[model samples]
Target: MAERSSTMKTPLNKALAQRRSKRRYSRRSCGEGTYLGYTSGRQTVLKIPTSRKKPKSRDITNQVDPDQVALLVKKEWHLSYVTPLYQFRYTMLKTYSKELSAFLVSEKQQGQTIETGQELCFKVNISVVLGLAETNQDAETIYIQILSKQVFAAKDEAQKVVWSGLLTCINGDVDYLRSLPPEFVSLPLLCTSGPESLSALVKSWLKKTFDCCFGPICITSTNLQWLAALWTGCHPTKNIQYLKLAWTIPTQPPMDVTYKVNPQDVWKLWDSARLDDGAEDSINIEEVNSFIRGLQTHFFRHFRLDLSAGSLMRVSTALGSAHHSGKIKITSPDYMTTVLQLLTECALLKMPI
Candidate 1:
């Protein structure tokens, strides 16, 4: 019985040894360091050490110094392709006897102003809210609304605005800034809202005398007759580039809302015979076209316009038919549709590449 037991034990031990050798050979061929053994029933299996050097434990004391650590921040700028509101810097310097000191700030300083403002009310596309503007009214000083939330301003001392800077103003107001003399106002851009500003008054005065070729003009009312007047050499406002239109909506209390014309206005220009009536030379054709192109492309591209998609489809269909006939003719009772049709013709005639 003892001899038979020994014989069985010998075969079992030999089989185990053969398995271990095969594992070592396979691990070496595979280029793995070694096979860490797994559990077999209640026993734990272990791999033979390939090297005498023990694996060192991680150094718990080795750590990064707090002073040596660096913090990284990322910044972003508005893209001109995506937004029509181009970024520009306009700073204002003020001098007064009221013991107020002014500090000139960079375009970056504009952000500091907006961060400290009261409540963010209206935000169009691009806007910067400086501090607040206090206007003396009725022999009393009143804190007017956020001076320039959309317009940028420099940092001011106390709650009062000493000297201001328009880091930038977006949309239609950008056009008005072109007409202003440098460093004249609290900010570069003029107020598009409220009663006509001093700049508007000056531009209006210039328009009356026709002394200036270009002026920041405000139109209270819009009519096709005005376009005819400019075309027929009645009054030359063609040079008047920065035009702000006030749409008067009468409520319980009448209020005038200042708004830039939509891209549909470009369509209006197309329908007019003025552009084609041999009066193109008399008018600032280049300026008008340029303004139209800018409005249609950039301004329209950025802002949301409630243009009728159905109207556009119909206009496209009409244009296709006209193109095939080698003659263009579009007639529509809807004003915007008519404008669309005329624009298509103009594009074909002038902008066709």
Candidate 2:
């Protein structure tokens, strides 16, 4: 009996010693800046670009349908970041449209408190906008329009478009995009312009169908600074008309400052700050800092206050307008891709690992 008990104790002691060795090894590996199971050769951290190329100013109206472009430019879109959609196909848009329409109608019926004749009927239209993709890996932009009419309306009455949404990924990170599995389609940015309730219902439907998630993507102060610099850089090729920035100072009453700069004045400052004499096609972080400093200095000289001390809340130019609350209005199609690329980076940063 004593010999048998010793044999069992030997294996138990050996197993406990092995676990202790593994724990020590793991701690030592972590101290040496290494993960035990992961290879250092592959990058696990996502890196966002600090500098970007100046957008080329080209008319895209001829490239895409005018009506679609009009819809995108006319409305102030609320932004959201979406996760990778599983099993999403561009070929089944018609089926998706029908299904979405039915879903909306059924959802409305369940929550309806109105009389029968006053009930609202919905129609959903989904179409693929061509020529917007910047890479082969990118999926085509999907445009959805929801029209509504009274259930008992006359046949000749025209239905009104109550909601519009766009899902697109332009100039996405190739490595991160390629890392996704074949079945997952990465359209990480969503822009919707419509009622909040309708947006919530649509998001719920998408979540149920695609097995994904959506979250609001608020534009941070840093991102707004980037936009201000990027849009100002385009003044040479495209007239920005005016540059307007809104700042909120935490004073006794929370003062708001709206500083508007002349286009030519800002353009001259930007040109003076450029490292290359219009030779390089890209803008760097140093140049952006210089441009912003010039503006803040000028404002400080006039107001006797530091504009940099306040929070940047909004930025606007002829090309587009962006607010800190995730609202954007793209007024020009020439630089739309560049703007979308920046927004795509923001959305990608919000993705869950």
RMSD of each: 36.2, 18.3
* Deviation of model 2 at 307, angstroms: 1.5
- Candidate 1 segments exceeding 4 Å error: 1-219, 222-269, 275-353
State the lDDT of candidate 1 residue by residue for 169-244, as single tens digits. Answer: 2111222334444422212122122222322332333233322222121210111112212222211221222222
Which ranges in model 2 have alpha carbons more than 4 Å from their true place? 1-56, 112-119, 277-279
Which candidate has the top score in TM-score?
A: 2
Residue 205 of model 2, lDDT score = 86
Q: How far off is residue 339 in model 1, in Å?
A: 22
TM-scores, all models, native as reference: 0.17, 0.81
The TM-score of predicted model 1 comes to 0.17
C-alpha lDDT values of all predictions: 0.21, 0.72
Tens digit per residue, CA lDDT, model 2, 283-348: 544555566777777666566767778788999999889999999998878778767877886777
